[model samples]
Target chain A: MRSTCLLLCASSSASGGGMEALRVFAAAVIVVGFGLLATTAVFSRLQRNRFVAALIAGGLPAVATGWAIGPGGLNVVDDSTVLLLRPLLVACLGWVGVIVGMQLRASLLATVPPLLWRWALTDSVLSAAIAGTGAAAVLSWWFLPGSFGIETALVPTTLVACAAMGWSPETRSMRVVLTPSTQQMAMLIQGASGIAAAVAVAVLGVAAQLIRLQPDGTPVLDLRTAVVDLALTAATAAALGVAARHLLGLARRKRGALLVVFLGTVAAAAGIAVDLGFSPLLLPLLCGVMIANFGRERLASFELFIMRAEHVVALLLGLLAGVLLTPRIGLPGTGLVVAILAARILVKPVLARRTLGPVTHGDANRSPLRFAPLRQSQLSYVLAVSVVLAYDAPLTRTVLTAIVFAGAASDAVPLILGFRRHREVAQERRSVAGAEA
Target chain B: MGERTDMRLLVLIARSEAAFDPLVTGLLDVGISGATVVESRGLAAVLRQDLPIFAGLAAFLPQTTGSRVVISLCGADRLEALRAYVAELPPGDRPLAIALPVDSFFGLEPTS
Candidate 1:
């Protein structure tokens, strides 16, 4: 027994040495990512250009890591690492959704339904078809190859199609950066995105059902369950809205109490979601919408608190995405990247121009709704897809990381340029108006 | 107070151009003139500083820099005319306008 123990210790020590080194490396990456993010935050605050800050803080580290380790850099952290972080990620997402939900409520009231709704429908259809088709083509060529026959491709394609509805929080981010004046446009875009996402989610659920077959060829995610789930999600959202209204009334009387209530309600909802096997994102979004649209005036004023929390969560999510990138998943084929970029930049803009042409012209004098074009949305979609893809192919974790990195990069450049342009135009207009007067 | 006459005053507070054009025009249409305007900043506005130089010194200094305050004093008989004018002004939360009674005024012209 003593001899056996000695042998076990020797072998364990050898493995420990290698594991310890990897752990240190992972820790270093996390620290560096956080440091960069902190720097970006500080710089952003000083400069008052949050878009620039987001790019620097969230984008730079992800790109550097992706370049160094290739697509699979996140693999170094191991599956166990992701497993541990998953709950935290879910919690963070929940909090973010809540905050967004609150904001959405406020924005919805200000929206002119017919025009905004029309834009949303158009964007959703175009984005989904383009993104889904692109993802399907890329994944088929690279991962599936000859593995999928036409029948099998349907499920994966559906998954990819639904995934195509992904959009970045860029519009929301822009709202934060350009406040008061641009609020109307921001609210419209947010409303459009929310509607589009809902539609896409519905498509995804349908697709999931279509593809879900047993070993002998039966169905999973039965239609009844899907319907029930949908109903429940809607009901939950309504309940959340009612609750927020009551909470807001309470909050008005005792200012700080809302924070505690907000946290508690979210925690309970998250728990319920986990138990019920619901789309965790939907309920919180509903809650946010309800609060923003229907809650008391005082609750609307407490939006700053929710926004602050969203920023922190978004930062953390970006950092985690960075750490998750591994060489295998990170190394997206150049063709695929180009295709994704093209779909977002070229195809999306064209579609947007075509669909929103009438609205654009009519509202030329009024504020233009600034949807964070396909490029930004594509990055967010890619990140979400990468994470979803990771469930099946562990190596895809790197791709998710790369998505975060690329998104940070792509989003930063355009946002900074856009912001500068917007600022200049504003200044020019102010001067012109001043001169006119 | 002697006759208990109705009156109106057009009060305006703005940093930019004078927003009292409509009010003034409306008041003129109603056959009222000779208003007394006083400019002062609110306590909150006066306490605000461009740069937070010294937390301690902030209490000593006024809250804001370059704030314009205008109070229009008119005859008590023009209250109806003033209410209509104030209602037409652009609405906002801060830099508000309020109408209060004047018990008596000396050497004021009666509306023609």
Candidate 2:
């Protein structure tokens, strides 16, 4: 491990610094490994109980654990340590992107109820619009005119909007739900969340390419460059996907061998994407989409393997987010959070009533899925962290902090509402039974 | 030894993967050394596969079925013993077993 670390440092001689820096890097890797292991052990123990398992599935607890040990709290995961783990974090992000992308099996999706797609599209557009406009206003007012260009603000705002477009897909923790009554709604939420996550990641990846920061942190808009980069990345991702699929076949359906193929593919794609100023989330996502849509039967077990690791990857990213978060939710940050919350709380339900109502046969008050939209999508964290990585700015950290807070808060909304719904449901059942008696 | 009419094809559908071990042990103890175990899934597993990754943990839950089907050819005495063994197992761990009469069979080595 030391030799490999040294080699990695040696290969990048320009920024390798010296012995002390290498020591810090090694320490960071050890710290992060131990942190993840300890966190996993605790989480695994807690998840044995179905109820606790559901709660942990939402991902805030992992984030909180990360935050607790992070520099802001305990100084265990300091900034320098996080900087050293950049490549690993990028790979983790790619892992998540692949999971999201793998859900895009066209054949499978075609069989889904049309209501899911409609809900996903509606939520994506409205959430993005609400988040983008509100964030733009806050950001515009927050930044001085001469400090930065509109493109700088535009990129983060767009990414934030993209982050706001989905809800948590976790249904196991929702114990209050009567499965028979809410099964369709739960499935709809899960399916739409996947679609919304795909849209958000893709849009965030594309929007990220539109702006490039110079050595001095000046944001430059280069449309031709963005388009060319995007096209190249997409082509490269497709090639990688084909190669990965072929390699997976050669793996002889062994889980260990399949895992190696996945890791190598994600690492290569993420490295290339990061090197080319593209969102590392896009390439592996495209690769996953390719893998899912083609040669699917052969790779079914592989898909299962990836899905099995999804929560672990998600929690890892959440932990990284916690480590990377600066908790500097300034005035603009506060406003942005409020904007996102208002949109999720107010706009989302009304939109659901207007669009999903007809098909669902119930509006917000009548629908079992009423609170489903309130929980922020876990993919939002992935996007926010990607932005933090792309731009190491105070503003980006604030965005991440706001997202974390919003996600946690949004998660609570569903629990409270679901409990009330559960009680009301029991009461109604008893009343009906009494009348029948 | 009894005639071929005494043979029975026993099919045990273990409700979970964990149930196969004791079942196989019991089958072996009942003098049935040959059996085929095939991995199987319940309808819930199929539906769970359609869920997004967030709820994919359903695949790992203890309650979720990872069923296996065990098929074997045995004599009436061994089949009864296997059935008795299965009946002795805890209700939750016991697999559903069915015995079909076998008219003819081959590939058996007669003991010297």
Candidate 3:
């Protein structure tokens, strides 16, 4: 009896060791796969777009392949892989945010009063209404009906609301969709979207507490505490920005000082945010905005650095998203998927047109303006928000993953069509000018 | 030397043949007529598998886009004309012009 018991313990220990080894091996494979994808992506400059498309196309099938591979697909990977990938994704996002923030700095200051006020009001109201309604509906139907009570629904809804509230305009894509005439219209739409996103996040936090039936029904961190934390984060970023501006001023004659300062500040802001448990995304953006508004000469210098960093980050994030996406887990029910598509494709664009009718007309007749296509960057923001949502509600992770994949697919067609239209318009203009000449 | 003078070489490097017509026509309007256009591949134009090797070979290879390069060598006397001409041609933020001293040349005779 004693010998039998000892034998059993020895066998169990051996099995544990084998399992650990398998996990490490699986992690190694994923790292290798990611590295290859990143390398391929970076090297293929013109082909980068194609490569990304291919990767996304392969994602669903790859998930299916994982499922076919059995227990190794579901259980072989460790938590550490997720941990490693998260920072990389955050860093990439931080870099993009910095670039965006830099671009918006000038506009933020130059924006007219009525426009600014309208934007503030519109964003706050729309973001709150959309996020609140969506959360309520989702919670009532999905969570409340299941084992999850209001408490569980509260956290998820808050997460969704926060995501809904934080919209970053896709400036890069806007250049594609509308001609110069529609730029202001585009900018207005983008501005409103961003404000809405921010307000949504804040309201969601408060609403979550209320729904959770927690004492005070407010964020555990009071308004004062949250404000202080936000201020500290902003202050740190500002100080870095100022330091960068001064260093840049002193080294105005230096060839690469601008690059150094730009990179150093971006990295520092992102790192600090990660360490402090604050939003890494917002800090870089704020820093960018501050620098853009204050440092005119340095702006050009900062742009180059930001672009290089953005490319690196975008590639890394794309690869990670590809690796982590499991189509099986978070596949939204057909109804939900259709609803999301309808909201994004039909409802959102129509609402945007109604809100921005005059501006769109103005854009059509005028010079290549800043903003016309209100829908610009909306897709990317929606995708990013979906990912953020996934982080909070692990169950929806797969669905969000699918959404990103599908969004990418749908986006490609519109982009191509828009590009072709622009080309035709440009050609027509040139011919007319030639005829006159 | 015929004259001790400074001259500018204006080069138009384009990715497509379609771009060549506008660029050349614009240059012509600025009194620039003759230019040496070459075809070469750009760094970004290289294939993915060939990038590492291309980066290594970049030092040895001439800076070419495989697209088209138009080079106009103007005399020192024509500097102002060339500058005005290039300026009017297209708005490329980067400098596409290089000033080099003409030591000697043995090509065509000067126009009357």
Q: Pick the DockQ winner.
A: 2
Interface C-alpha root-mean-square deviation of candidate 2:
7.1
Share of native C-alpha contacts between chains A and B (below 8 angstroms) recovered by candidate 2: 0.10
Which candidate wins on TM-score? 2
Please give the lDDT score for candidate 1: 0.47
* Candidate DockQ scores, in order: 0.03, 0.12, 0.04
Q: List TM-scores for all candidates, in order.
A: 0.57, 0.76, 0.56
Candidate 3 reaches a DockQ of 0.04
Give lDDT tens digits, candidate 3, residues A115-184: 5446445544554346445655754665446544454454444444343332324333334334455544
How does model 3 fare in lDDT?
0.45
Ranked by DockQ from best down, the candidates are 2, 3, 1
**Which residue pairs clash in candidate 2?**
none
Top lDDT hit: 2
Whichever of 2 and 3 has more DockQ, that candidate is 2
Instruction: Return the lDDT, model 3, position A206.
Output: 39
Candidate 1 regions exceeding 4 Å error are: A1-47, A50-78, A103-110, A145-221, A235-248, A253-256, A290-298, A327-336, A354-374, A378-392, A395-402, A405-437, B1-112
lDDT per residue as tens, model 2, A1-437: 00011102223333546754765665466445644663454645565453464455566877887788787776666555666666777788788877777767777676666766777788889888988888888877774345445677767788779868877776654545444445555556666777788888898888878887665666778889988998998898889888888888787446578889999988888878877778888887898778777675535556656665666677677787887777778777888888788779866777656655554533233544666767787778878888777776777878888888888777776777666776787898899999999
